[model samples]
Target: MIAERLSLQLPHTKVDPRILSALVCGSALALLALKWTRQRRLQQKLEEARRKREHALMEMRTMSLQFKEQNPSVQLEAILSLPLTELVEKLREGSLSPESVLYTYMGKALEVTHEVNCLTDFLPECVAQLQDLKKQKQRGPLYSVPISIKEHYDYKGHNSSCGLAYFLGTLAQEDSVVVQVLKKQGAIPFVKTNVPQSMFNFDCSNPIFGQTLNPHNHKKTPGGSSGGEGALIGGGGAILGFGSDIAGSIRVPSSFCGICGIKPTEGRLSLCGISSPVYGIKSVHPAIGPMARDVDSLALCMKALLCDHMFHLDPTVPPIPFRDEVYCSTEPLRIGYYDTDGFTLLPPCMKRAVQETKKLLEKAGHTLIPFNPLRMEYVVGELFLKGLFPEGASALLEKFEGDLIDPNLKPQLSVYKLPQLLKRILAFFLRPVVPRIAGELKALCGIGSAKNLWKQHAAAEVYCQEFIAEWKKLRLDVVLCPVMGPAFNLGYLGKLVASGTYTVLYNILNFPAGVVPVTNVTEKDEEELRHYKGHYNDHWDKLIKKAAAGGVGLPVGVQCVALPWQEELCLRFMKEVETLTREKSRSTIGPRIEAL
Candidate 1:
């Protein structure tokens, strides 16, 4: 009886197949509708942001025109032509008022932005800031000087979106520590400039603000992620601006735009309130520095920024103030110079710029020693890439999810987003063909475990030690080298990101480095560029050659580097190079290239 009861089965009822099909179709429709709604909302936000920016620009232009009409004696051209130092002098001596300088720069910036699309948002709060500054009895070093900043720097009540639609509506609750220090020093930040999405790529383009073109040649990129600051200064719209660097952000832009910019030692200024693309990476640190038309302007900004106020506002920053003696010293330096890093070959113009600068400095009584960077490919792979993103591209890619990706970033993102197994296979096959890229690909494929991440970071520390030991052995006060560009064509960085080794090497060492415009690309430089097949003769090398074409008359710059916490000395080196370059251009007989 128990077995018979256990074997008993229940009767089943059947449902309509048509009902099941209808339910499935309805569920698919619901999902499609949800996706459409989300995309529509994002599009509306993007349009709204564009409208806001345009409106702000219109208001600024209108205000500037009214000021111009009201003050006919303000000579906009003459004032705009003055360098930062002269402008500051005029302001101090009461020959020019703060309002005139502000209006002049605002009008000029508007003109430049129209041509280059560099600016994102004009600061209306500038009027209030100027009013406040007028009440101060003791004027700051940058008194009444208008400055532009990279978009990610926090300004109280403004958005600091790093060119992503996801972050459009968020407002910065307080000023970035650097901004706070600038305000105290009487520098008015009148505009925020555009940046590449996530501030990851070296070329400046984003879905929200669009692309920022090189002012000198619209077909070329001005270099990024500090590109806007470079364009603004390079175009004579602003005398000085602030930009931050992690890799080659500041110096590359400076090189491409023919402006001067410095990347200070990590934490030399302040990073508090700047919206970094990736956080919690301990291997490399991002730094804040100034960009300007002339080296003196950069030095002046540094002097103002490295003050008690900056130290007080950000306790994490080293409290050392700018040393006047170090910047102003007349002492000759033991300068080490290199044209290439051995991983990637620089264009002929870039190499010539380095060689020429070395000759100039040597003539000025500084000793020039040849220096070769050690294991640059390894440093870029393990230290720069893996060290900066130990967990891989997930952190950066997640930021762009649901947001429109810039075309310039797609190639780079695709490389990092490959499947782990696929990445290994590609690396294995690519090792002999393009070893540099293979090494980088292997590093970018996320560290599989915490133990591996720790090992990578330790390796970075060891590499730094080796680099420092080499530097000490050379006994060099400064190093002179080629900066990565005379500006490449737009969108090429997606395929040639590793070309930044010339500048990234310094960032990895956390050294203070500056870029000074040394010369303009000559016709011969472009002619020689045709033969540039890099060491590997790979696809990347061909891409670099193509990117560098049509760059004649573009400005070329070189890097000046010093040890950590030696920002003052770095600036001095840059200033020396700038002065010598100017004198060479003015002389009937230029410095002979083959004299050395």
Candidate 2:
């Protein structure tokens, strides 16, 4: 009774004024310190890079003057024009010397690097390496052959910076497995090419190296993360270039630049000593492959790499040697064709390119059966994206560590920065407007828990099984599909992220795929695309048409895909498609080939 009458009282507490002030000030100072350190290091590396470029440019000018005084037994034009296969033959037969070949390539590379800004690191020790090769008798398929590599591949003395300022000064202790194999085969990687900041964007630009312009048109992008490789090969600077593709990194540039590139099924090639922002992530693993002007050159590259040498170097890769018989087969093939994936309807130029190829293939006696589109929405929204950012995209952005991100990457970078409430509001509004893309963004724009990641893996396995079942039911030998094309204009990749459906599908399926040039963009294609309408709204409809404007003469290509580990067959089909496309373009009359 007495306690009730008194009533209960509680004391109010407060932190000491000095302690609160100290905690706030301490955090502010630490943040400022970290940011300042990052800025200083970034500036130093960039300055070093600038100095190096100036020196290299000076050397190039001197080299050009000297070339005029020397005599090349093979005409300079003819020597520079030869393919990898021919280059090797000439070198071995004594018709071409390593010095002459190297000099010719060096001169062209200098011209190209200036034009497209494609090279990141020119081989500084190349002169010494050349002298060693000259002194020591060399014997291999690629003896004295000049190769260009993507920036990520390891070289013993040089940094494989991969467009990251943080990795700038750290030299690799040893060469990558692929690089060792190339050297073993006597291929000389004279330079490394540029990539996007994260090695993720399709448009190639970074704070450290600036942007890589398209060789076809400076206004358009060359395409990436293999953008520089595409530009170098397309410009005739390098006969063959090495690049990696997890999601059209190899094929997009190949298609955009009017060249050939292949993304082999995962585990078919070694990936040791390669630098990446995300390591130990296999959900959608990046694969190293060759990019070249012609399919035969790519075949030669694969033939050289898929050997006993690399297998022994990286025991994780299966000891699978190149099968020449598969590539040389003459049997009539059962080929399936699809003009549109229904996920991202390719532009008229792309579809037309595919149609022309289908016509040629039909005339060649290969049965071109119609193949329906598979479950592509799941591939893009659920399987691929979830596997890629299973912990959510937040962790991926942590890679930058408050360093500068590329301007061209802002659209993608913005997605990760969006608050959950904001994303939901945007998604809700976009659902009725750009429904497809709305769903794609929502699925891809966050971190994932362990349970969600498990679900993603399970879904991918299920999708792969379903796709294989469809392939088996069709009894198809090879499938001809349209690659995401014609290349987008500069600065459009973020808006068209969903357009990569065609290329990324094969990657998710782990299918061996190749991109082959079929035709150039035409006035008709541009006109047809102008009137084209989508199931969605003007956001993409207007953007898509605008990207195709002024795109005449840009390269358009088709994708050829086969089951996993069927790379030999995939290349064989590519070779056939390439031959037919050439013949068709040469003569308006259909080109007849000996029955497959």
- Each candidate's lDDT (Cα)? 0.90, 0.83
Candidate 1 residue 216 Cα shift, in angstroms, is 0.2
Report the alpha-carbon TM-score of model 1 versus the true structure: 0.96
Best by TM-score: 1
RMSD of each: 3.7, 5.5
Q: Write the per-residue lDDT of candidate 1 for residues 507-573, one digit (tens) a residue.
A: 8788999999989989999989998898777888888999999999999999999999999999999
| Candidate 1: residue pairs that collide | none
Q: Which predicted model would earn the best lDDT? A: 1
Displacement of the residue 511 alpha carbon in candidate 2, Å: 0.7
Assess every candidate by TM-score. 0.96, 0.91
Clashes of 1: 0
Q: What TM value does model 2 have?
A: 0.91
